[model samples]
Target: MLLCSLVAIIPLLYSVDAEQSLSANGKVLELDESNFDLAISAFDFILVDFYAPWCGHCKRLSPQLDEAAPTLSSLKEPIVIAKVNADKFTRLARKYDIDGFPTLKVFMHGVPVEYKGPRKADLLVRYLKKFVAPDVSVLDSDSAISNFVEASGPHFPIFIGFGLNESMISKLAEKYKKKAWFSVAKDFSEDIMVSYDFDKVPALVSLHPSYNEQSIFYGPFEVEFLEDFIKQNLFPLVLPINQDTLKTLKDDERKIVLTFVEDETEESSKKIIKLLKAAASANRDLVFGYVGIKQWEDFTETFEANKKTPLPKMVIWDGDEEYFSVIGSERIDEEDQATQISRFLEGYKEGKTIKKRISGPSFLGFINSLIGIRTVYMIVFIVAVVMIIQTINKDDEEPPGVGTREQGDNASSSVSEAESKEYRSGEKED
Candidate 1:
């Protein structure tokens, strides 16, 4: 009887293991405290969604995750998608600091980083593909180059070196791998040069597809020059001013010579940007960025730019709350825009500018919220309401119509108890 029982138990265990293996193959695995560690350990790259069922965003995101799971799992090195009911598994939520519902984190070798990409299935797949891609992809043909660029999508900058040795870029490629896509083209035609608009061999071309911009550098490919070119091209010649774009500037120490126009689509604004681009290329020491009052009125107004102040205005921003405006070059007229910009630069260099603070919090401060600020505020409000209700219930439970002195003592005791409970609650949260 003992031998028969052992034989049956072995088969049962094998079947359980097989079921788990199949579940992880191409489906979104449902995980909890018990199996969360095992699941993360099993996959090199796993995207885990810590969600609460009652969250509307989580409910909507569920189907997108299901749709993306199979495609991601079918890759050369599969990426597993898993979800945890963080509300039910309080320990897991606490460990990951899941303050908001439907928090997505991509775990690489058991290290977690918050996922701030798109939520749709297709965009999410493209975004996550960046994490798994090789640091430097080698392209042997024009078609391969095209295919690689297409697969890379338009989210990050792309650096492709033609007729250049792989060893030349391998180090910088690995160093800046997370911020940009690096690749080498082993063979290509002169038509390719004309296509990418480079006239020389051993040339490095940087493409910002989203911005419809490209830059090329030929020769002097020493390590320092190459690295400097790569760093400069990480941002487009004239960067656009937006929340996402501003986040990219946090690490860049260069101050922004920013221009504000009434509307970016206007012919005058387009002309202004063209002039700005010329200045940007000549003066790579300063970053050139532009914002349209029509596009981002709130941001533009922070610099004191308005329809009445001047249609085309300029400022030098420290990527924070403070900006400096040139005394005489604050406004650019239509007839003499180029000369005015030159004067503005000269004035800035001569210390002919006034320093002022932005009206509100810096853009980077708002972008630092792991989840959206509205969601964080909502969570705080809900917790405060619950604590208030609990305190009221405790007060109601007190015995009615005690002696005056006794009632006062009871009230003090109740207040003290509430304060202690609140402090303990904060401690546990921390």
Candidate 2:
């Protein structure tokens, strides 16, 4: 009976373990070191989550992945959601340089691309849908180009490669598909090319239909050149400073002039933006951005800005040097703000203004420096010595009752003598 019971419990435990290994939706593939390469080769588009069992974020992401797996698997060109336990499979983790847990990488044709978008299920599914279509669509006619531009939503920029092979720009298109729409036209009319002032084959043009702005790059279809061209022209003259834009500005080696305004709708903020636009246009070397102090309270705290520091205040941040400077003794207004910014720029270039280092809270360090550690110890010792001396002096003083009894006796004797004298005088008078 005992042997039979042990056999029954072992099979039940195995069944439970098998069920736990499957995804919540039961559609995702579970891969390990033995079959990772085989599965990567099998699937055209696979999203792999490199995770550790001990990671809290990985546990949170597991449910989302399971929920999204079935929907993604049902697509016409399905995407496979697979995962590897990085802690268990050390070799695979090291191969991918998996430094962080819950890292998502999208594999296309066995090549891995890091997925940097949001981690939610809906967002991940939407981003994966891009891989279902070709990276670069071919536009056969002029109307097709216009229709494509009109069909693409207003926010995304459009890139059209004229007389270039599909293979020439496919990789670039795939890399930046989230940022912009990419298309190629093989037999584009010379007239269209001339309109954009393109004089060579393999020419590329980036168009912003909403703003009626276009940029032309004539030669060098190399990845580096095209990337730089797109980056320089993709954004507006002034950018909003967020984590993404801040990294881009730092990578571009551009000094930032960050304006802290009260609110976006204020008249002063509007004027400051206009002035910043003019300044950015004139000084392409500097990146300009503005933050509303009310909206982003933490940003002001990070920069140590407060009510004492006036709003519509501009500060220059040198990303390379990791220091910042503020304008001295002058208020910036709509009329003279541009002049003041230009002067500030000139002063920065000539090293005339003071710069504060970017550092964490140093209140303790400041106090320590104001009064040296040795001086603090010395002061404490002196205070302790004075207190000890005062306590000793207090102990040495006499108590109040030491002579009170004798004084009372003397007073009693004097009273008795005075009574006797009064009695003798009365007897003599009788």
Candidate 3:
């Protein structure tokens, strides 16, 4: 009977395994080692999911990808969704350097770029849609430029390429589309070019309509040079310290001069920010950032600035060295705050400034960090010792019993009375 049941179950399990290899909805292409290169090269944009059959995350993502396929296929330039079983094709997985299951890579022009965005179908579709549109829009006349600017909000900066075409500026536009709007013009009116101070062809100009600020780059059209020019001129001199801004600051090797203000909109904070802007302009090597003390109390405490520390305090955090120095508020609040900051920068460069390590919430934080997970063991040990001591102290007390001789005498008198009453009853009966 057992052999017969095993034979029946074996065929059922085999059928189930065969069905697992089939597509969820026949939308995504299953490419193996033999056809991987051909499929990737055929599509201009292809998102490949390198996954393993046994991976639970891969199983969950498969349905989402299946649902997203129809939407992705409706784009102007459709993106193909492909999957590779990394476990089955070890060599192909190693070729793409697949270290984990369900690795999504976006391939464009046969080049693979790792996709790090959200895993949701809607987000994936939206992210892939950006690739469908031409990166650089061609603006033929002055009216076109104006219309484009009007269409896009004032929040987006405009990068205009004069005497350039889409191909010349496409890569730059694609790289910075999320940051700014890119446009190209083959020819512009002399007045327009002169207004932007455009002296050469293939020039890149960043225009900020809201701030009435414009920056022009007339040098080489190399990626690194253009990126540096845009980044340097795009952001404000003084930046707010938040997660995004902190990431940008940490990416560079510059010393960050950050000010912690109690209230961001207060007059004092604004004044200090203005002063820091001047200092930043004079010293381009240092980055200036500010944070509201109340909103980011935990961030301030990372630098050991607690309630005891003065407000609007400036601290220089050296990312490379992993140390910081607190600039005196008196110096920061002085009439010549910029000069004081400049001198502080010089002192820091000359190694005359004192450096301090990043602090934690309390002294226990240091011990806890040093001990790591053993801190939990230490806590449990201490609690056990305390409980044992309490139990021993409790047991040392006398057990409850007859506490006074007067109570004992009362008990004895009651017993004697009862005995006498019984004896008198017996005598009466006799």
What's the residue-level lDDT of 157 in candidate 2? 71
Clash totals in order = 0, 0, 0
Shift in Å, residue 129, candidate 1:
2.1
Could you say which candidate leads in TM-score? 1
Q: Report the poorest 10 consecutive residues by lDDT, candidate 1.
A: 421-430
Q: Given candidate 3, what's the lDDT at residue 242? A: 62
TM-score on alpha carbons, each prediction = 0.75, 0.57, 0.52
Q: Which prediction has more favorable lDDT, 1 or 3? A: 1
Q: Please, what's the RMSD in Å of model 2?
A: 22.2
Q: Tell me the tens digit of each residue's lDDT in model 1 across 1-430.
A: 9999999899788657844663557789988876788778778899999887766678889999999999999999788899999879989987888766678899988989777677789988998998889888999998999999999998889999998999999999988876899999998887788999988888999999988989999969999999999999998889888756776888898989999988888888889999999899988889999998888876776677766676688999998778998998878998888899999999998999899988644333333342443444455566656655765565577655535455556655765665444323221100
lDDT of 2 by residue, 104-189 (tens): 88898898976655567876676576666567889998777777776664455788888878887888888777667889987667
lDDT of each: 0.81, 0.68, 0.68
Poorest 10 consecutive residues by lDDT, candidate 3: 421-430
Give per-residue CA lDDT, model 3, range 358-388, as digits (tens): 7676534323323332233446456555655
Candidates 1 and 2 compared by lDDT, better number? 1
